[model samples]
Target chain A: MSSDKNNINLKLKVWRQKNSQTEGAFETLDAKNVSPDASFLEMLDAVNEDLIKKDKEPIVFDHDCREGICGSCGFMINGEAHGPQKGTTVCQLHMRHFNDGEELVLEPWRATAFPVIKDLMCDRSALDRIIRAGGYISVNTGNAQDANNIPIPKPDADEAFMSATCIGCGACVASCKNASAALFTSAKITHLALLPQGRVEQDQRALDMVAQMDAEGFGACTTTGACSAACPKEISLINIAKMNREYLRASVLKKEELSGGGDG
Target chain B: MLNFLKSTVGRKYIMGITGLVWMGFILGHMAGNMLIFLGPEAFNSYGHSIVSNKILLYGTEIALILAIIGHVTSAISLTLENRAAKGTRYAVMPKGEKASTWASRNMGAQGSAILAFIILHLITFKYGAHYETTVNGVVMRDLHKLVLEVFMKPGYVAWYVVCLLLLLFHLSHGAHSVFQSFGILERKMQAPLKKIAWAYAAVVAGGFLSQPIYVFLVNR
Candidate 1:
């Protein structure tokens, strides 16, 4: 572990709110000197401790795994989402990237659907709702097939992985002035639908997910590409274009019967 | 208008229009206020006349408020459509950093900053002692005196300068954005549009900043 000698002090202007119903405002705090090697979450932990020591409510934010694998922890750093580091998750971000005495403004993701649950914590479950609408493939439970039963080309698999890497963090939604999620949804749809196995329920998946995404009251994508820039996972706007194509295909084909006539 | 509102790009066009309209308002307001540095009596009467004309001022205020709300709503609606269009996600997105302006991407943030400043300014000056106040039977709105009281404060001048900076950035991107959203901006028009946007931004931003600098330095 790196020593604390390299740590720098920071001032944080964090937005605090009790819930979605209440109005929130920025509250400034002095972050004590801390290690530059500490993960972003660890730095938050340090700040939270100070708040607790003063008997004030610790800032409420979300984080599942500090390892950057779970796609939970996300908040604005200064004006940039996930800090100034490109292609880096918040939890993986280290203090060394920031200058000493800099004023960091932290806020929950700004989107209509993802309202602030509290300080730094936003209700991003709207994304999960969108996924649940039609993000899955229809497969049988009892089938144990050989790996050779389904042949996936290396390039296709790589593409699938590329699209599948979307953590669904809502950074795309947050960064967008319009708060659109087409990139995130299309990424999931294209990742699976591109493969032979996914083709079975591709049409249904596109229709259902897009319908749900709309019902969630999320805004439309204007192809501004801000979402991609702010995304911690760097999900591409190409996925959004793919989703548009898929939605058009599904809408036009109007196929009533899903593969195997089973609900996904 | 209804037909235009029905389409995808149409709604964005509306947003761009409303946004540009608000930007126009900002430019006009800044230009009008900068006359304060011309000397207290000159700036004072202008402020007084504006306040006295309840019909014009209130009408403009209502329109400004509506434009702001429309811009915000359109922005929200467009974002949702973009998200819904993406079927799945990719690890690499298009290179957005180099393509769009800083103001375009940070519209929401900039809007928030501007809104906060407006509220502060309204409370501190517009509705405060700077305006025509009543003491007994006397109508006491000293326009020149109010100008000095507000701008002579280094803090207020500094804050005004910051607001103008935000306005400048907003106009620079917003001017071109309106035309693009309308689909009126073609490859042939790009060069001219770029020049126009820069000039527009410079005039508005420069005009507004001139007020504070004049007051803080010359007037003081």
Candidate 2:
């Protein structure tokens, strides 16, 4: 809609917070003379430059590898996780997608598991802890195996690849009404469970990761499909179904087969 | 298994299993209620057959009661935990996926209301005034008379109307949610599964809904 305009000047209502310990509020600011081709984060950078020139503390947000691969740089833009564009991260969103003079509301992910570290920046370490608890396969170190060694089926490989694409951006958590980390946890579970190398510890992996996810105070999965719909990677809801199946296996698994956890 | 049930995923399995059980009961009950349109003979006979076999009737009753208990306990536990998990509400969070938020988001309120309705429903119908009737030289509960009498009251019909609506609202999400909880809802099956859930919910709830209005209006 803004293709006709060389630049779009917009109003921004950004969430400002000192830290998780304190209260947060919305701070209204203006972004003027912005190029339509500029990414969403670039517009923020421009606004930050202006704030610096005015001797004010600029807005704090998380971002790395502006290429959209770093699993960083995500905040709610008008309640839509990673902005309104489907399957595109905020870092990849251009200003042209938004109308000129539109009011852009920016806030960090809202969840007990993702506490605010600062303005538009939340601590997503809970996701890391889920991985640490057991998001791994039993791979021996040293020599690399050829990709064709496993002789995996094409569909399985494709599904595994899709599940592996989850960037851990917390968009799923932000989008879910319950703020359940089911999508994030399930994606890792699916990615690891599908491959042969990870199959050995699959039961324990599901158990530990899901237990850790619950321990993090994240909500339960209602299977509303919101997380999958809002996912930037388009992670399928099947991962969650797979996660459920894996957990079912854990319940039936004998004590000898279960090694407790994948903490090692 | 105890440790597994303690986990969120395990609790959901409980929710799913009980949910399906309720679905089956709802289907059978709604179908049997349709005999009301077939007159007292058919309705009374069906009721007679149900209570005639003490073991079967009591078994079904116990099973249904257990399903309700399982469904309620797990739902309450999950809801409380979910509430606490969302530490704070967002100042500007807009509604996401309208189709989802409507039923899924309101499941707690709707479920609680439905539970209350179930309690009152049992008292009114199961333990309602016992009227006797003889058909084919066999004594039976005049449930048809009780049904007709209750529906004739405007307030009772209105209550049924309201409760049926809540049932539909709750069923819309729940019908589909069962598949997800059981790990059966694959990507290819998502659309069909959702459609089946809606159709099933509508049929069961709608079937129950038609009775009160029919009884009240037809008799009047």
Candidate 3:
């Protein structure tokens, strides 16, 4: 592996689009020298600097908290979501992982629900809309409750925490051949459905969030296991299965309500 | 009810249930057909017993038809919806680095082939030339002779074997996926479930293919 002391030269093929309405194309640029210790985003920063000095338009990309925790930065690196590194986000990926004289192609997340807005930025509002539909507990808070007030089993808490690790990045959607949002929708559903506090609105949450997911034009999941593979958090595909169970239960309950034979 | 079926998850639920129903029918059908190895009298007797009761026979036929319809319609809708959702294709598509299988990816094409095979199979076996036989003072359709006649032909036997292989491909993916769709499969249980599905597919396909091979060799 190339270390920080060892610099490498590479060819970068980055997608460049003037705006959402315009067509995008790959712009080849030469990275003459780059520190192996630089993060992937920093490498892009170097390339952008070169473009600005040459009086060319700097490639635009979305990023925040370059530390990889913000969930604000993501783009396809060589047809793989978040580059070739496993469980690492784009911001956390380092130039050292790539070899010298490598040809790298970078593009935004590809999905009908996530349309490209610029060079490497896509509109991810569809995810936000699904969450808005019903991703939260409706509990009103006046004062903080003691952590031990509500007892949660260890396993359930651990699983809930795992499910809650989803960053709402569009990698799952990007990697899926069907562009399915099942993983993303399920992660949110599973996170809330596991906790006692989130159970009160569980049925509604499943129904509304799934409906919103469908409304956003994301494809149906075929359970090919690609989403979980592409997930930066390694979110389990079982979460999608769990969400299916919840959705089925909620649908059946809704049917009962429609027939006037059960509590809505 | 219609709205539920129209939704993606609801449609998947239908597909899962109907696919399982079809799997049940295939297993039972293969077991019954395996009686062919017991000679003409035994095979013919078993066939007669099954079709002897009009209610049981017609009920099963109708249910199978409905299952086929449900499975096909739901699959087509989901496939179309998925295609539309994809919007535009990536210029450079990459193979999934994780657990996707060929059977899982080509379910639509595999399902179509299986449907065509089913149509031809029903036509040749159910509506082809009839033979009558009498055993123990009871009259029965000589299904054993009919199967022999069908398998005696090289073209028919080849087609039957090919169809069985296609069915294996369809079932390999469908069996385990049905469980996943219903959310009945736990995380740890998925690997075992997949193994069971593959084993089931292999056994069913092997069993069905054995008949034609056996008949051909015996007659030769």
Q: Using DockQ, give the best candidate's number.
A: 2
How many Å off is the CA of B139 in candidate 2? 1.6
Residue B121 alpha-carbon offset, candidate 3, angstroms: 0.7
Q: Which ranking of candidates, highest DockQ first?
A: 2, 3, 1
lDDT of 3 by residue, B1-220 (tens): 5656778888899998888878898899899889888888998888888888899899989888999899999889888878887776655555556435788778999899889998888898888789999988999999888888889999989888888888898899888888878988677897999899999999999999999999998855
Whole-model lDDT values for every prediction: 0.73, 0.88, 0.86
All candidates: interface RMSD: 9.5, 1.7, 1.7
lDDT of 2 by residue, A1-264 (tens): 234447888999999999989999999999998888899999999999999999998999999988888789898888888888878788998888988799999989999989899999999999999999999876668999887888878898999999999999998888877789999999999998898988888888888999999999999988787788778899989899999988898778735625567546
DockQ of 2: 0.70
Ten-residue segment with the worst summed lDDT in candidate 3 chain B? B90-99
Off by over 4 Å in 2: A1-5, A254-264, B95-99
In order, how many clashes per candidate? 33, 0, 0
What DockQ do you compute for every candidate structure? 0.07, 0.70, 0.58
**Candidate 3 accuracy as TM-score:** 0.93
TM-score of chain A of each: 0.94, 0.94, 0.94
Segments of candidate 1 deviating more than 4 angstroms: A1-4, A257-264, B1-220
Instruction: List model 1 lDDT by residue over A77-187, tens digit each.
Output: 765667778887799999889888988888777777787788888888888987788788767799688988888999788878988888888777766555666678878
Q: Model 3, B144: alpha-carbon shift in Å? A: 2.4
Stretches of model 3 off by over 4 angstroms after superposition: A1-5, A254-264
Q: After superposition, how far is residue B150 of candidate 3 from its true place, in Å?
A: 2.4
